[model samples]
Target: MSDDEVLLSHDDGRGVRTLTLNRPHRKNALDDALWRALRDALAAAGEDREVRALVITGAGGAFCSGADISGGPRAEHPTYRMRMLSDVALTLHELPVPTVAKVTGVAVGAGWNLALGCDLVVATPSARFSQIFTRRGLSLDLGGSWLLPRLVGLQQAKRLALLAETLDAEQARTLNLVTWVVPESEVDAFTDGVCDRLVGGPPVALAQSKALLNEGVDRTLRDALANEARAQGVNFATRDATEAFAAFAQRRDPHFTGTWAVPPSLTDMNGSARSPGPGHEERLRQAD
Candidate 1:
């Protein structure tokens, strides 16, 4: 398949972008080309200021089935090929914008880990998941070793990895692998609503909050608090914080543009805009 055919991207015009793994005949399996395409698409979304939320799903009623091992052998070294998967995994995990995985059918092996890498995962009742590397005579790849243990505790992670247990939607949710399990009919609408809420949120603040949670797990309390303080300072420098305060006072929803607010120097000690001299008003125009 062509690169674009292997991975489809659509923007909803309301700041939500959806990426579909398009190789459904192979259960959306990632061939080497698809891995590259997925990585590039995720990187593009991260760089796009207009994309406030992202949803990763699969076409033809199935989520990914992991790597396309059925393909003919290649000349590349195993480590080099593994690097491609690593790049895709890290790019998805480090995205500043919120991400959701909409799972309809099976998500196994690296496919399951891909879903887990998202900030949130929504699955239909019939969806299935497995850490199937052992069944395939392989070990966990695509951040599964790190994500699974943290998500489900070491004991549960070991059970899943060693046994290659297939989990239904409810079972996965109980283990904290899936965030929500909606009915098959409602999963699309439910995921859309969730993404809509994320899209409407303050982008700068949300990004900071996501970063803090991702990093806080590995930091001391004192370090985490210090990092939070720094994040709050950054948030306050954005127009969204001021808009949020104003909206709260007015009892209305805040509109966030993620623009930089007036700098401290451009604002007086009283927190009002300061015109240092003639024509300074234009200089104080909000920075993008």
Candidate 2:
């Protein structure tokens, strides 16, 4: 499919790739074309060595209002829509690099699950999330049943899904569903800032860390520790690690070359801290 068919726009600069859903009139609703475009964009970004971070956002105002209900796409294969949506969600989860979802407005049903697929979510104060499937006599799609439970816990997930209630940005933040809630006008800036930080960090370290964390969710502590140690050994041999240590000794910032083999220790490693890298505390403090 050609780029124009996807209603997706991509921009890359300074190791960051921003993909915007361009179907504004439909509130960037999910459709087969849109999903295909999203998958392609993500794959493109992942394959590009220059791209260190990826940010997904919707054009115009709304993030996404769930699947396109205007007939064409959904009507084409009603029963298969569930599987298609789940495939899209799984594709997002498989992204190799760090991904951030920037929500400026409404994110309902499948749209909410799409944002949850990203590693981090930053929403504007005007943003709202809802699981409206039950209200429409439909079940959750796009891996919502699996993803939501792990995110906000089974009970809270059930309450939202069953009630089909709208959750504001602040409420979502309190539930730990979003990383930050900024003014609507600041959404782009905030997302860009996050991308900048990710791009500046050690690439191999970040990727390994993300993988380990994702894997740890289902692994035993002993297995996780062994996996982490292996990851550390792999990363220890990378040029990025050499630079990291050198920078530490020089009391200067590290400039990574992106050719390093990811360390196994970096994967499966755990710490009490929620965020990664130095100055993470400062970022949280600023958020507070």
Candidate 3:
């Protein structure tokens, strides 16, 4: 990949698109170029009608070390840098398709947040995640504040963010941050297995399910229930759902067809929380 392009290598087969982060030297850090490339890749995958599932992984042993502090043009204004980073995080959160993060090694700072952005994370036993912002006189960037709290609750998220503690893959799994932790040697195979299941499943059903879950997090219980009912009503009208019920009646596998559009309301849903904001990493480190 060119320097301007985030090292994005993709393989599309079996209805799955696997996008690998290429900057192994910097541990796949999200530099400006990398972030742009990632956005482009995600957009492409989302638009591809043939792509049923998407997987994001690092090229080398490490999943991602976080923001590429050593890379990118040195911004004269700190505010600009913060804004750019926040935009990247927002892009990850807003992806239309279900995205999976495959972690094999250390994921720190922005890297940890990137993994958090994905719909699910599949990690190797040796994988480690750290919020090192405090140690570096910074705070969590790249949606760490938003994503972490949702995954682990406010108290645990605060402990990780405030302490800058390193969590092993096993620990992360126990905390419900990662879905699965397997032996390092089996990481690739495990990720492939997950992709296989996702790709073979009903695309419309899966997309709606993801949309509902993401939206539900920010909604009141009644609103969420109503949203769920609305989604279910729409899903029941889809050909995929029809086929699913038919297959169940016949005792056979159901084949899904066509790409479905995620509802605009689901996509536009927003939540209220303390603006853990972008420059927390710097502030925390300074206090230390």
Q: Evaluated with lDDT, which candidate comes out highest?
A: 1
Which TM-score value belongs to model 2? 0.84
After superposition on all CA atoms, how large is the RMSD of candidate 2?
10.1
Give the clash count for model 1: 0
Q: Would you estimate the TM-scores of all the predictions? A: 0.90, 0.84, 0.83
lDDT of 1 by residue, 1-288 (tens): 375644545565778888999988999998877888898899999999989999999999999999999966787779998998999998998899999999999999999999999999999987999999998899999999999989999999999999999999999999999999999999989998998899899999999999999888789999999999999999987889878888999999989888887656767788888666775557555442
Cα distance off (Å), candidate 2, residue 201: 0.9
Higher-lDDT candidate of 2 and 3: 2
Task: Name the best candidate (by TM-score).
Answer: 1
Query: What's the CA error at residue 27 for candidate 2, in Å?
Result: 0.7
RMSD of each predicted structure: 4.5, 10.1, 14.1
Write candidate 2's Cα lDDT for 187-284 as tens digits: 77878888888888878778888889878877999989998998887777567887788799999998876564433323445523233567655643
> Model 1, stretches more than 4 Å misplaced?
263-288
